[model samples]
Target: MNNKDMKIHLTVDVWAAQKADARAVRFDVFVIEQKIPVELEWDDMDEHCLHAVAYDAAGHAIGTGRLLPDGHIGRMAVRAAGRGKGVGAAILKALMAQARQRGDAEVVLNAQTQAEAFYGRYGFSRDGEEYYEAGIAHICMRHVFS
Candidate 1:
């Protein structure tokens, strides 16, 4: 269906990182779809982080991401069906807004190699060499607002 005809009502909400809705979306995208090991998927940092979750018209979580206390953004995930429909971008934008509200000087993330361009569109610039995490290629990116 065309973008307008799809009628995909997406709502992004920011909340505590450990909220069930956020965790559910991350589990589906990161662990189930990407096969990231459980050990690496769940971390203690979640409790202290700010998370954003995108929910569809049916109230089902479709995308999620988080901003850590140190200005690091991670755990970004969008369901397969949610890709290319602006859901990921929405999630990222919400997290960035949260960072700005907190007075962060900069925000950083390890972007999956293939998704670097996506982050770049949001003003994030590559900051370091490419590296591997969870067997996936990633590169450090940062967006400075101050």
Candidate 2:
């Protein structure tokens, strides 16, 4: 990795996600980039979910993910500039760590259809038929570990 890629740091916090940071990153990736509706972007589950945020060296929020008590991971988003640079992986590792700490043997998520392969790299296996959420196609997936 180059200097720019190596300079970023990953921070994972359970129930510690800041609203401002989550909104900013979500706005950049989901709303502006993916054209997702703002009203749908933010939801009631946020307040009850454990969120993880990744920051670039300049202190900009570059990635975000959330884990629910039932070990459901969702809303994983990496900024355009931060994509393909390990931010997503790092954030995922952090979320898994949170799950492990809570004694979860696995984590589940409804992944976007276009991103199934990406989640597969992290050991998430498709478990059900394709479904729609927020007007986008998704697949139910889960990560199992010993």
Candidate 3:
């Protein structure tokens, strides 16, 4: 871990109280930066997923991701200040840990193609053909526990 990672704080929580921080990070990264339609950025799944939020040293939420009951991880987003700082990694780790703790066989995600390599670094491999969602190219990736 780098300096940023050392100072980053992470929490795993339900959507009820973590939605505000998680929503802010997702909105800024997906809706604003990526130009994804706000309607497509949110769904009922959020209310049922276990969320992981990463905060900077100052306690500002900078990254967020969630793990669904079925072992699917999604909605990962990191703001500009958190990019390349291990914020996304921290969030992803927390969500995957949550899934593992719940006895999930594997954790899966539809990763934007541009981020395929990032997921690969964590042992996630492509599991399907490329597809488009909200005009962004993506490929399903999965990491099965040993």
Q: How well does each candidate superpose onto the true structure, as a TM-score?
A: 0.89, 0.90, 0.96
lDDT of each: 0.83, 0.85, 0.91
lDDT of 2 by residue, 15-38 (tens): 544667877888988899888989
**What lDDT does model 3 reach?**
0.91
As a whole number from 0 to 100, the lDDT of residue 11 in candidate 3 is: 91
The order by descending TM-score is 3, 2, 1
Model 3 Cα lDDT, one tens digit per residue, 16-40: 9799999999999999999999999
Question: Would you list the clashing residue pairs of candidate 3?
Answer: none
Model 2 pairs whose backbones collide: none
Query: Looking at model 2, which ten-residue stretch has the lowest summed lDDT?
Result: 1-10
Using TM-score as the yardstick, the better of models 2 and 3 is 3
When sorted by lDDT, best at the front, the candidate numbers are: 3, 2, 1
| Best prediction by TM-score | 3
> In model 2, which runs have C-alpha deviations exceeding 4 angstroms?
1-6, 14-17
